[model samples]
Target: MNQVTRYSPLDDLFRGFFVKPMDFPSGMPAQQIKVDVKEQPDAYLVHAELPGAKKEDIHVEIEGNQVSIRSEVKQERDVKEGERLLRSERYFGQVSRAFQLPYELDEGQSSASFKDGVLELKLAKKLAQPASKRLDIA
Candidate 1:
């Protein structure tokens, strides 16, 4: 059966305002890691958007069909003797996201790179192999 997908701008707007913030609890704001996954003929490309994060604060892990991306963001300012804070709205905390793929991934062949606050991962698909024979019950 053929399926058609629909795209809506309002959905994105509402999600950005509501759903994205819910990732943090107790009113403690945190940076949210948003990701986009694209599948090709032979591999999958994952693009994660992590603004205001340093390369050393990010970590990526792949196990079986699951892929996880985590990052920590820290922001601090030294106030002068006569300076007073006016307003601040930036978030500082750790955030992580995990997703599972339909196909097996070739971990050894997968590669990841980060630039301009975006992380890109190229995951190669593992070739399917026949399952081994099952042993009889004792």
Candidate 2:
């Protein structure tokens, strides 16, 4: 069998910092990444780890078989006395992730929840009646 390698642009994304080490497999102020996908007979569950993200910052949308997850955050510190600016390496921008759902999911029956820096989404796959058919052998 031939080797197959699927590519995703966000696969190597870092939350806090974008730049990766040139020599070592390391990055500064590392970003959090925890994704779990579970499929049942009638539904699908998706869980994503998003730390330091607010409800207003997250935006979810589903179109056809594609589900898009996008979030944006901006942090600024005002100049203050006795406090000098130091080297900063944390991220202050937007990040997004998209996935292609396997089955057709209902838009109304799906829901999402966030707690402890985790985002959980429940998607219900629509049920279609199976058609009767006979297999043919050659």
Score candidate 1 by lDDT. 0.88
Q: Pick the candidate with the highest TM-score.
A: 1
Best by lDDT: 1
Worst 10 residues of 2 by lDDT: 21-30
TM-score of each: 0.70, 0.64
Assess each prediction's global lDDT (C-alpha) against the native: 0.88, 0.77
TM-score of model 2 relative to the true fold? 0.64
**How accurate locally is residue 4 in candidate 2, as Cα lDDT from 0 to 100?**
96
Each model's Cα RMSD: 16.8, 17.9
